[model samples]
Target: MERPVAVKTVAADLLALPDWRRTALARFEREAKAAARLDHANITAVYDAAITEDVCCLVMQLVDGTTLDNVIDCADDGRLSVLAAVSVAAQLSSGLSAAHAAGLVHRDLKPQNIMVDTSGLVKILDFCLVKVLSDTDPQLTITGETLGNVAYASPALLGGEKSLDGRSDLYAVGCLLHHMLTGRPPFHGEGPAELVTQHLTAPPPRLTDCGVDVPAGVQDLAHALLAKRPEDRPGSAADVYEALAPYLPAPAPAFATRRMPPEDPQRPFLVPHGPVMPR
Candidate 1:
C-alpha cells in the first residue's frame, strides 16, 4: 500500500469531551467522505480517517503551496494581481459549486482555508467546520456563543441566527475576494464582537478605497456576496461563478505549472499576522 502523506492530524483526545463535541467531528468525517467521493479539482481529497480511543486522525492529501493569506501578505502593494485574484475566486467558486451540489456548506471560507498549490491549483480545505444541511442532527448550537471564524462569517451567522445555506458560503467567498484584492477583510474593528456587528450593520469599506482598480462587475459581486440578508446574496456558488465568468481566465489543467518548492513541513505556511480581533 502507498504510504500516507506526512501531515499532522488533530488528535481525538484533544477534541475529547461531551457528545456535543463529538457530534461535530462525526459530521465532519461524514461530509469529508462525501466530498472525497466526488472527483473535483478544487476540493481537497481525503485519504483516510481513523477514530482511536483518544483521537480521530484524518489523513488528507497534502497540498504543497502557500495559502491565499500568505499571498496577501507578500503582495507588492497590499493588492493581489487582478488576474491572480480572479483565478483564485474562480477556483473557489468552483469548489463551492461542487460542495453545494452535494449539500455541504463550508461554514468557514476564508483566506486561511484556501490553499493554492504551486501550479496555481486552488483547493478548499478545513471541512472539519462544515455544516451539512441534510444531516439528521440538530444544528450544533453554542448557547451565548457564535460559531465559525469571525472574519469571514456571514452576517446572518454572526448574528446568532441559524438556517444558513450555500449563500452563507458565498458571502465568505466574497469576503475572501475582497481581501485578496485589498489585503484586508471587508470589516475590521477592535474585536470580534465589533466586527460581527459591522457585518450585520456596517457598509463594507469601498474596494476603491484600497487603491485597487477593481472592475464594476467584481465590485457588484462583492457587494452581493456581502449582503446582510442571506436571501439578498447570490442564490448559489454556481451563480457567483457565472457572475464572474466573464472575468475569469481560461481554465487550465489542474496543477498546470511545475510543483512549487515545499515549505518547512514543521511550520505552518501562513501564520496569523495580527492579534485576534476582540469579541
Candidate 2:
C-alpha cells in the first residue's frame, strides 16, 4: 500500500499499537466523520482514514501555525494580550457550538488542542478523544471507565462518571481560556493528582491575579465556562460566544488594530484610594 502524504502537523504520523488500540483508532475515525458533518472553523478537517499493516492512520488537514499553548508562551509575561485571548475564545466557542450541535463532545479541550494557523484561522484539533452522544462505542467505556486528557478532564469524569456530554468539553474550554489569559491552567499543583483535586475542590485564582487585564465579560465567560458543576456553566457554546463577543476584535475587513480593552470590569474594581491594580 502507498504511504500517506507527509504532513508536519501533530498527529500526522500514525503510531503503531496493539490490535485493540487499532480498533480504538477506527472508532475515532468514524466519530471524526460524524463530527465533520457539522462544518465549523475551529474543528480540524478530517480527510481520510486508512489501516496500514501495523497502524491505523486518520488523515486530517495540516493546520500551519502555533498551538494556543505555545502562543501563550510567547505573549508578554506569559499571558495572551486581552484582545488576542478574546479572539481565540470566540473561535473556540464557535467550534464547540458546531460539535455540540452535531451531538458530539470534544471530551478533550486545552490550549494544546487548539491550533491557530498563520493566516489567523483558529482550528480545534484532536477529535480522537471525541464522544458521540447517540452512538456510544463500547470501546469508549471500557467496563464503565472514562478516558480523556487528565489536566482538562471534568470533575464528573474524575469521579468515575460513565457518561460525559457537551458540558464536559465546555469545562475544558474554560480551563483553556484561563490558561490563555493567566499563563497557567486554572487548576495546577505539584502533580496530576493534585491538579485533579484542585479541579474538584479549589476555586481558581482570579484572572486579574495573574497580572493581566482581562475584561469582566471575558473573565465572567471564563468563570462560567469553568464552573465546577456542568449545570452551572452556560447552556451551550453559543452562550459562551455571546459572553465573550464584546471583547473580540472589531469586525474589519483586514489589518485592523487589535488593542486591549481600556479596563475590564470583571477585574477587581480599582478603588481610587487603594494601591493601584497591578498592570
Candidate 3:
C-alpha cells in the first residue's frame, strides 16, 4: 500500500546492545500479535510487523497529535480539567474492555503509550509489552528488570504475580487518571527499585491531597483502581467505563462549546453517530 503510515523500529539503543537485542526482537513481535487481535476505536491499529536477523519494524496508523504525557505537560498546572480527565478515562476503559475481552492484557498502559489526536480522540499506542492471557509462550520480559513503567504498574506486575489480567491494566488507568488530575503519579521513588518497593507496600495517595476538586465518587473510583490488590480494584475495564460514563459529553451537537481543546477526548462521544476517529 502506498500511503502515509507510522513505522516503529526497534529502538536504536537496544539494537546496539547485544544482550538486549533478542528480548527486544521478541517483544516487537509480541506487540504485533497482541495489537492485531483487537479492533477498537481507542487502540492504535497495527497494519503490519516484520523482523529478521537484520531488521524489525511495525507499520501503524499514523497518529496526528500528541502523547497524553505531552498533553499533561502543556496543560495548566500540569493537569487536565476534571471533565477532560474523565473523558480520557472513559475512552481508555472502553478500549481496555475490548482488549480484555479478546484475552489480551496491555501490561504497559502508561500515558506515554496514549495518543490524543487533534479532535480529542484518544489512541492507545506501543503494545511492545502486551501479554496474551491464553498464550503459553514464554513472556519476553527479563526477570529482575522492572516491568513496564513502575510509576503506573499494578502490585501484581511490580511484585511479580504468577498471572496478570485486565485488572492490571485498570491499575494503570487509575495511575493515569490520578496523574491527569494531579500532575504527578500516585507514588514516587528515587529509582525503579524503590518505586517497585513502594508499589508493593505503600498505599496510593488520596486525590484530595492534590487539592483537585473532583466529585467524591471520582475520588473513590481512583482509589479503588489503585488498590494494592487487583481483586480490590474495579472488576473490569467495563465497570470502570461505567463509573466514568456519566462524565462523557452528551452526544448532542447542540452542546458544542465556543472554545475547547483541539485534542478534547469528548469529541468522539459527543457526535451524533459520527464516523469513528481515524485509527
Among these predictions, the greatest lDDT belongs to 3
Itemize residue pairs with steric clashes in candidate 3: 120-263, 120-264
lDDT of 3 by residue, 1-279 (tens): 788899989878888898888778877887787788789989889898888877798989998889999999999989888888998999899999999999888878888899998877899888777787876665465777666888999899978875899999999999999999999998998998898888899888889987888988899999999998888999999999899877766786654543445676667767634544433
Lowest lDDT 10-mer window, candidate 2? 264-273
- Could you tell me which residue pairs clash in candidate 1? 12-55, 12-56, 13-54, 191-278, 192-278
Please provide, for model 1 over 1-279, each residue's C-alpha lDDT reduced to its tens digit, 9 standing for 90 to 100.
Answer: 576463445655546656556655665567557656656778888777766555556777888788878877877776676666777787788888898888888888877888876545788887876666776565454466556789999887777656768988888888888888888888899998798789889977767777778899988888788888888888988888788878765433332232333321111112111122222
Q: After superposition, how far is residue 3 of candidate 1 from its true place, in Å?
A: 4.2
Runs of candidate 1 with Cα error greater than 4 angstroms are 3-8, 19-21, 250-279
lDDT of each: 0.72, 0.69, 0.85
Better of 2 and 3 by TM-score: 3
For candidate 3, the TM-score is 0.90
Tell me how far the alpha carbon of residue 44 in candidate 3 is from the true structure, in angstroms, after superposition.
0.6
Question: Which ten-residue region of model 3 has the weakest summed lDDT?
Answer: 270-279
The residue-by-residue lDDT of candidate 2 on 218-251, one tens digit each, is 7777787778888998898888888877776554
User: Cα deviation in Å at residue 18, candidate 1?
Assistant: 4.0
TM-score of each: 0.83, 0.80, 0.90
